[model samples]
Target: MLYILFMIGLIWLGWKLIVFAIKATWGIAKVLLYIVCFPIILIGLVLGGLIYIALPILVVAGIIALLCGE
Candidate 1:
């Protein structure tokens, strides 16, 4: 019985750790996306003459980032 309880606790903690790792990875990914990828994408779009499509999307993203403070 003690072994079973120990195993259960270990599994629970392992699951929690996995979830935390996924969240951290996602947060890093988003930060990199906004900081690095967006600017490159904008440059690509402008050079490709898709500003009409990219402009509003960038504006909305800017608003969201400003309001969310992230």
Candidate 2:
């Protein structure tokens, strides 16, 4: 009985740790996407003469940034 309880506790702790790790990884990925990838892609779109599409994307990103707040 004691061993079963111990096993349950260990499993719960492992699950919580995995959830935390996933959250942290997602946050890092978002930061990299916003800081690095977003600007490069935006510039590529403008240089490629896709201003029509790029303008909408830029507007949406700006709104998201404002809503999310730093």
TM-score of every candidate: 0.77, 0.77
Candidate lDDT scores, in order, read 0.94, 0.97
What does the lDDT read for residue 40 in candidate 2?
95
Model 2 CA deviation exceeding 4 Å by range: 67-70
lDDT of 1 by residue, 1-70 (tens): 9999999999999999999999999999998997899999998998999999789988998899799985
Model 1 segments more than 4 A misplaced = none
Cand. 2 Cα-lDDT? 0.97
Ten-residue stretch with the least lDDT total in model 2: 61-70
Candidate 2 C-alpha lDDT tens digits along 1-70: 9999999999999999999999999999999998999999999999999999999999999999899987
Decoy 2 TM-score against native: 0.77
Looking at candidate 1, the ten consecutive residues that score lowest on lDDT are 61-70
**Pairs that clash in candidate 2:** none
